[model samples]
Target: MASARKRKAAAQAAAQGAGGGVLAVKARYDAAGSGRRMRGWNPPTSGPNRAITGLQKIRDRARDAGRNDWSGESSTQHWTTNLIGIGIVPRLRRIKSKNRKQELNDLWDAWVSQADADGVLNFYGLQTLAVRSWLESGEVFARLRPRQIDAPLAVPLQVQLIEADFVPLLDADYWPGMPAGNTIRQGIERNKYGRRVAYWMYRDHPGDGQLSSAIDASRLLRVPADQVLHMFEPKRPGQLRGVSSLAPILARLRNVADFDDNVLERQKLANLFTVFITRTMPGGVDGDFDPLTNLPVDWGNDGLPLAGLEPGMSQELDPGQDVKFSAPPDAGTAYPDYMRTQHLGTAAGQGLPYELFSGDIKEVSDRTLRVIINEFRRFAEQRQWQIVIPMLCQPIRDAWVDAGVLSGAISVEEANDAKRVEWAPHGWQYIHPVQDVQGKKLEVDAGFRSRSSVIAERGDDPEQVDAERAADKERDEELGLFTAPIQPDPNRSDGDSSGESSPGRRPDSNKAKK
Candidate 1:
């Protein structure tokens, strides 16, 4: 007892030496306190802390859910279709020399056609794959492979896509050949100042073979940081890696899917029209009863019973034997409403509108749909510009230009001039075509928005659109075709046309104008 008291005193003294005394912090937030409501509410302090322990398991489950669950697939497809669409086409910007700009643009177009190291996917297709993988696996890597100078290519640069699995989440105090004072966290090597210096990656995917041996230092390749492109949407300030977009909703998706399957099975059983035979006495049973047909069962070659129900079939029952039909409960009328509510949660978790994600428009109105779609478009635009453009597309562009300059295919001056570029993502179709076009026209006419900006928003180059328009006009002139000048809608009496009502106007509008 005296030794125990001495030990406790020593511990207290050590605590006092470190600081003034043992600090007892009481959190003011009710949620952070050890209250009844806060029971089982322990959460990690940061994103990395939460992700570091079970990242691989989370990624594997997410990929499985994406493959199996409808909601998971919907989330991936919604982002890919909206954020990527056909492709985010590039437009060279602000090149003083028109000839140089055209040449650089043409060269870039050619290089992108065969950018993939495997020669299977183009650059834009790689973008789609990267985005899909990012959603599925949380993060993806691209190795910038500089080709030989004499290689037969427009630009001597190719991109090799690497899955997140390539980089092992190996947190170590000191790895083999690691510089002093640098620590490895989640497979990334960081120097003293916390700058990522390199990545420890496997030469081949560790999960590629079933008989894969235990990973060792020899199996890891230290790749320079600049050569690899890491694409992931970071949810925390100092997150070392990404967690799958489906991670948050995976359990919910599985629960919803299981419920749906159960409901389906219940409905199927409910419609089975099964009849059960009850026997009163022993030794009175003649043959096995078929639940499906309520007829005598026959054995097959495999010793399994085969039963059939034919129309107008009659069966004889022994004495004291009676038949009762099965009346299994259906999936209730609330099933549809319950499913809709569950799907809404999944859609919100995926950052998508319910209508777009689930393809359910039974309860959607035009105005409500318009609002939902606009909000979704804003979300997609943020992802495109912030994550995809800067992380994936711009780096590839810069690498292409550098390769072109190095390979002597492009002059240094031209490469420098063509550095500025604009990547335009595909535009969405108008919800109300006529109204949308008229609104754009009004905006353009009133100088509230520029015509160039309008064209760009439609995923077209303004200069190219103008040139196409000029060509069409020239062709019409050459063919002597009468082209009417664009005018305001005859039905519109919004005071822009002297409040005049012309042909095709409503009688009430004309009367009011008169």
Candidate 2:
């Protein structure tokens, strides 16, 4: 019975010990599970546990700062900062800074450099160097250094000559008091007064002077002397003995029988004279005559020689007859018959017949003489050619280049290189050589700008300048910047999954998204 009791107590103790060990193991498992659940439920608070919490705080701050909105305001800023941290932004910034510095330095250097080795800072020099650099480097910024030497563009002197001639007709020996039947002889003497009086009447009557003299001067001047030509009329009885008084009276008559015939003859004579005179004059061309013909022919189609005048030609006398004159159509309205009646009116202190004769003759004669004088003046002015000396400088070259006025380029080593080898504005083809102070040969480059080089060397920034210019253009546009609509690209795909829908096509539904 004692053995049985001891065994039973030991068995009880073993069962209790096994049960306790099992319970302890179960508690440990439950505690571990609870701790793990708690750990996952609430993030770590401190130490190594605080790492994830700190990251969460950072993310929260970023969200509050609007970094979470991809298409919102802060998106670009956020991306930029992130990119900068990765090193791209810093490198870009550095590159931009380097470029700006280099550009500035180049501009500064150009400004300091002398335009010419001679130390002359002419506008042409500045422009040439600037343009050259721009063409070579594609930059337009250049600065001009102040030149110590003062050089002004030289202005050439202009010279002209004018000539006037005085020819006296009668010598003292031909005085009216001399002899008898000589009176008839004296009246026909061709003196200065007779010629002058003849001209006066021709202007009024259009038929005076030896057809040859009238034609010669007309052809030389390239004008119609017929307008001033006068026909010879017999002088009235009791007229002054002086050639001037009587010659004028005779010139006034429109009734002179051969007036029209004389005009026709004079026209023929004038034309021949034009050809001869033009051939003798330098720079003379047919066009230099009258703007009408522009031909080198004389006034009259008739080939009259210039050498037919006798020495003693005086005014003649005959009985005067009743005269009537007609005025041209364009005569002013204020003067109904002024050109005809008044101009051809009777001479003062002369009879009715003499008066009518004097008026018509003098009027025609004066008109022709005036026309001749004017035509001569015109020819003289047109016969001149302007001579200009060009300086081989940068600014001048640039100006010519920019304007596209230069025709061709020649090297200094070439013959007559310094000359302006170009066609005239009127299309005259000619080449002019440039000469030095000592008349030595100088090489001239034909393609030159009078002003462009100067403008380029003045230190203008082409790109920035262009950009500003573009901005100005934009500002001047009719549409304001914000009001302008966006243009859609034709190649873009619409937001559709169907392959049939082209990127550029718009959706059929026009409704806005909900």
| Candidate 1 lDDT, 1-514, residue by residue in tens | 9999999999999888666522332325566567677888897665554555788999999988888887888899889988898899888877877777778778888888889998899988999999999988999999999999988889889999999999988889888989999999889999999999999999888888562545589989999898999999898778889889998898988898888998888889787878766766556567676654445777899999887556898877676677797888878889888988998998999999989998889867999999999999999999999999999998888888888889887778767656668889998889999999989988987779999999999999999898898898688767766555445665656666643324334433445767
The lDDT of each candidate is 0.84, 0.29
Model 1 spans with C-alpha error above 4 angstroms: 1-28, 46-50, 211-213, 266-273, 278-310, 314-321, 488-514
lDDT of 2 by residue, 294-346 (tens): 33435444764223223574423223312223332332364435434533342
What's the TM-score of every candidate structure?
0.83, 0.14
Q: What is the lDDT of residue 437 in candidate 1?
A: 94
TM-score of model 2 vs. true structure = 0.14
Mark the regions of model 2 whose C-alpha exceeds 4 Å error after superposition. 1-99, 102-106, 109-113, 119-488, 493-514
Position 329, candidate 1: lDDT: 89
